[model samples]
Target chain A: MPDLAASSKRPPPWALRILVLTYLTIFLFAPLLALGVESFREGALSLWQGITEPESLLALRNSFLLAAIAVVLNVLFGIAAGLVIARQRFWGRALLDGLIEVPLALSPVMVGLAFILIFGRTGWLGPWLSQFGVRVIFSFPGLIIATLFVTVPFTAREVIHVLSEIGEEEEMAATTLGASRWQTFWHVTLPNMRGALSCGISLTAARALGEFGAVLIMGGAITGSTHTATTWIFTAVDERNNGAALGLSLVLGLCSVALLLLVEKLRARAHERR
Target chain B: MRPALTPTSRWSLLLRGAVIAWMLLLVVLPLVALAIHGLRSGVPFFWAAITEPQAKDAVALTLWTALLISLINAVLGTATAWLITRYRFRGRRLLATLIDLPLAIPTLVTGIMLVVLFGPMSPLGAWFEGHGIYVAFHSPIIVLALGFVTLPFSVRMVQPVLADMDRAEEEAAASLGASRLVTFLRIIWPSIGPAVLGGALQTFARAMAEFGSIVVVSGNVPHETLTAPVYIYGQVESGDSHGAAAVALALVTLSLLVTLFSKLMVRWGVRRHA
Candidate 1:
């Protein structure tokens, strides 16, 4: 009411507000509301028990391990690519930058299939590696490989964009001022990259937790072994065990929301800095 | 006095090289293997693999479903971004987050959410079934699942551009006797086209790649429903890696084409803006 007169200059029609509210309620809120309501319908304690159940725990454990491995791999990639694209004058830097986004635009199942076609027992590498008795598809190695494939660019993309904007003048100046390149990087570049690195890691971690298609296809969804939280949730829902599935989903949902918030904050700050 | 370049500089240079190597190892190599596998299997075999009456049907279904999702999301996403940016309303942040929630939620959970919202027992599900508009576990229903996850791309891509738009131009157009619709067409639209188109491509790519959610909802019938990704998975599981590679190659080619298309759109937008 206080700003009503101020809004006299540009008040969107009330109809617009009403329409937007109604649209979201139907398209976005309604279904998720169903999941949330049905899950807690039996009270939180039972849901908590479902979350702690051995099968649920095993799924959580497997997903966590898989996500951790994937994130570690991607972070190393992110730091490396971020460094090169930020500082190097390479012949193919532009092409490499373009290449980083290929995964984001590809289908997850296609990604899964790509992994299987390359690492499955009869795949090009699969047979050669099989000679060494290394199994990829339907194993932890497959899960990590697939997850890494999807996750590689998230951090690098984030870090590169950040690093690109932060010019090399500072690093070069520091290096010329007697600091070793390593020291200059650690003290200058690393500190500036802290926010991007954090954001990138969070994204990788969040996606790792939620990965399903690749893990399901390559990892085989064996109980207590290869089943990720997403796969476990899928199985539970399919088996008509809504209670346990919702409980498991809630856990992963919370992690995703948290990581996304961090990403949003970092990206917003970056945008504002511009 | 110039600070002496130390071993640190060389080491960091090597690190950058390693990063480039890593990108090749992680991204390029797997794809190369897939491509080589496709080649080894020969075009005759791939033609056989894909044209295996049912297999051809699967690829067609996947493309059409993805295309449908992209078309629907393009309209809805534009409407959403228009509302979110052009108006300041209650629950706007919640609306924004809800749209993007698909990006963060595990796709399998997305499937479960759809099932609960429209499965046999739910009120809407019952109504839809009663009206002979069964949405659960159906072909058209797959578009809905694809659209659910791809919805975020359009809005995110558009909102930032809209927020950055010059409203004075719109006002000037209106004062010059252009109706709101005409003003939007002449002024705002030219600016947002590339973004909307790029978003559409991303959605199409995502929809085609859909696995976790679609698999859950589609019931994965052979030619009637199985997507190319799922079809590839089936081949690999059946110990036919060569057949899988053939299909995987087709999927990868589609991805490359779509990505090039998106790049073209974004580049055109940049040039237009310039």
Candidate 2:
């Protein structure tokens, strides 16, 4: 630690510190504390009852299920995409690099709308797909697609960043030792990227778990069918079921905080290893 | 000279092609589809969708709140980043975790947090209502929600740059009898300026397209608090896909421009840092 205090030879600006504390408290912590209190106002039993309701339970289940599937898909795709971009010099690489961030830059709603335009009944491919009895929109498939779209870049970006930094020396050494390409990738590359991969997957899972706008638009938020925990919370609030809303919101918040903590841990561990 | 394709090279080629195709199908195709759908009805209808009074209000409110929130975020985020990067503080790790809460939590819950904190039912909310200061179902609440969602952007962006920055200049200034403020203004500001602006640009883009949190807080009041995303949502729900597409196109265009600008800034910052 550089002794900022000694260097300045002065006490810290207490006023500025207090201002930041006050601002964050008002904007972040206060709301969360209020949410906690409201969720528990009716006691733990009610909070339990709220999430245990069949619809809420189903919604929670769907959210977790979708997140799991999306995480798996994204990780696989991320590995392939990350390797291509990080290891290979190719034409249009810059364009592909730019495309990775397209999902992040656009609104979740816009992503959802794009799905609608691609997979909805009146969509370009929708009619053709429907001829074979395939349903994409207003279903689990829609939820998966939406979650995948929003989180598509997370794992890939992380892996690519890690791969680029670590370079290809280890893999080249392995290959020169007569190791097969797959052997080099698995033994040399995968181990090096494990920490970053986990961090990215966790981050993607967290984002997928909380996705709303795209899911709402693509899945249509149909209760007991396509409804996610987030969509359910939205409906609960809209229907004036504040108790249920607060309880579900608390549940979601807790899970997310836990996941974020995990991400931080993974990130710190990766940094130390690096 | 072009090398003949070996088995390993062929396999790698296949992998690259697969990843590229996957990305094209996942992001590029959907986006192209949206662009086509949005413009299918021609420019006159697109003009009409955007020129509607309600639509105009939504666009205006989105831009206004996004600007305010990004400015607030830039100043406060920079301060928070400075404190964390410069000082040895207790609970700094915990504070840093809290800053990333929004990224992990479902954004919809952000709105619920605000509602529970400032809704008419809570004590504080009731008191505010008694004093005729409304929060929920209003525009300021939208700004607050956006601020919460984007709070981490600038801080996260600047922290690494600040951490890696040479403190020798500041120490030299201090040794030369320069005030702390002068040291910061003369040495620190220029170093972190590009990063803060880059992060602020991304934050602004995020705020403009923010939906889940704002929807829950803003009450979607027509011509008052409804943002472009929510308005697009309403248009979609009402079976007005064209109208939704028009607004979505506008928001996407704005976000892409901001994202491109931010990317340029990132390049500039990296170059300058080097």
Candidate 3:
């Protein structure tokens, strides 16, 4: 590839570099640093106090638990969705393709509201389900469902991309060797999609960890019951417990940064392999 | 092609049906429920729900912030992408990773980061307040927070295109004495135009649907800072399910349109280039 910069002899590289770095510093790094300082402003003991507080710990635990649940569910459903979408030819396939992306674009709050409209007391499924003493909204199930809804596309999209690129040749070969569909999928397709599937899981888990709007709406932000870490931070902020809020944010931020680095590594590995 | 009813084909069909059923139960049904519930009170109620002063302001704020973020992100994101792709420099990898940082961080933490940095209690925030400017609980803060959340979309979207693009046209144009800006405008802009547009639209949709970060930063002040998603959440919390659903549906519909539009644009661009 020709070097556009070397050939064009554009303005000094430093100018553009400085501009880009300055923008990022002002917008991205600065706020994060500020939070870092605030979180530890009162030193290690205070940070520990904030994090080890029962409510904070429970919220953190809930966030991980809910995210893990969503990740497991997404892995199962997402692979199936990815396989069918990538490999199949059928009517209305394009419509499904479009619809699957809806969650990414739609508001999480709306996603939660949609579930409530179906599962809330006055909802279509509420009365029927209530007869069986089943509850969804304002519960852990609701939190998982909302997180699942918001994160539905990540794994499926990643797997679809990987599958599309890997194509159907190997699966066809396996089938021609008299392998059943299940065996072919498990042996041939799944191995090929492992990288993307893992990446998708990481992405899904990270997103679910950070999810707020949908969970807050669906789970109703009931402390010690439905409140995830993000909601707890919000509550901390609301109650003017800035130290606790900032501390929780610091922990979540670090975890996510680790996840981001993992994603970056995966992306780099994928590109290198490609 | 002839439709086959062989056992293998039947099994494949069953798998496909299973995926479809899962999607219907999880994705489609809830959306349909939301639509039905939102409109259950008829045209007048839906109209009133969306047109209430707070609802109207929320909608307006959502659009205004989304548009502002799109424009800002387009310029900065494109520049960042350009810098990274065209010019290799020290810390390029680190810069790229940092750019993707917001993606991994929970967005509610993003709001908290802003508060830690710029809330009234902080020294910098206090200085800004003294100057009659504010970051938290302001419309501009919403734009800023959403900008951070949506930061990676345009750059990530456009980066791959630039990497794969043939730089010969740019080199040739520059060799012909075309100025840097003119050469970029003439040669580069046309190539990446659709990509930037698509990314910008996606960014806009993301900003529009942003709830978690906005809720934390906006202080949820009615009519003043409450965004559409936050407003819907507030409505639900306030026991106005119909109103929340109506607004949620409107936001969902708008986002779906934008997302689909961006998808169409990308497809068209690919076909055009092909």
By DockQ, the better pick of 1 and 3 is: 3
* Runs in model 3 lying further than 4 Å from the true structure: A1-12, B1-8
Model 2, A1-274: lDDT tens per residue? 2223322333347977897898788778887787777766768887787888898999999999998998888888888877888888878987998898899988888888888888888888899999999989998888888898899889999998998899877777787788877788788888888887898888998898889999999988897799999999999887977667877888888888988899888877776665
Candidate 2 residue pairs that clash: none
Per-residue lDDT tens digits of candidate 3, residues B1-274? 2122222477668867887887798789988987887788898898998999999999998999899989988898999988888776667677778888988898889988887788888898899999999777888789779888998999988887787777789889999999999998998888888889999999999999998888878887887888898888878888888888888888888888898898887887677656
Question: Over the stretch B166-206, how does candidate 1's per-residue lDDT look in tens digits?
Answer: 67888899999999899988998999999999989988887
DockQ of all candidates, in order?
A: 0.43, 0.53, 0.54
Which residue pairs show backbone clashes in model 1? A107-B209
Model 2 regions more than 4 Å off: A1-11, B1-8, B177-182
Q: What is candidate 1's lDDT per residue for A174-217, written digit by digit as tens? A: 97778876687789888878778888888888878878877888
Which interface RMSD does candidate 3 score?
A: 3.8
Best of the candidates, DockQ: 3
TM-score quality measure for candidate 1: 0.92
Best TM-score among the predictions, by candidate number: 2
Q: Quote each prediction's TM-score.
A: 0.92, 0.95, 0.94
Model 2 chain B, poorest ten-residue lDDT window?
A: B1-10
Global lDDT of each candidate: 0.77, 0.85, 0.83
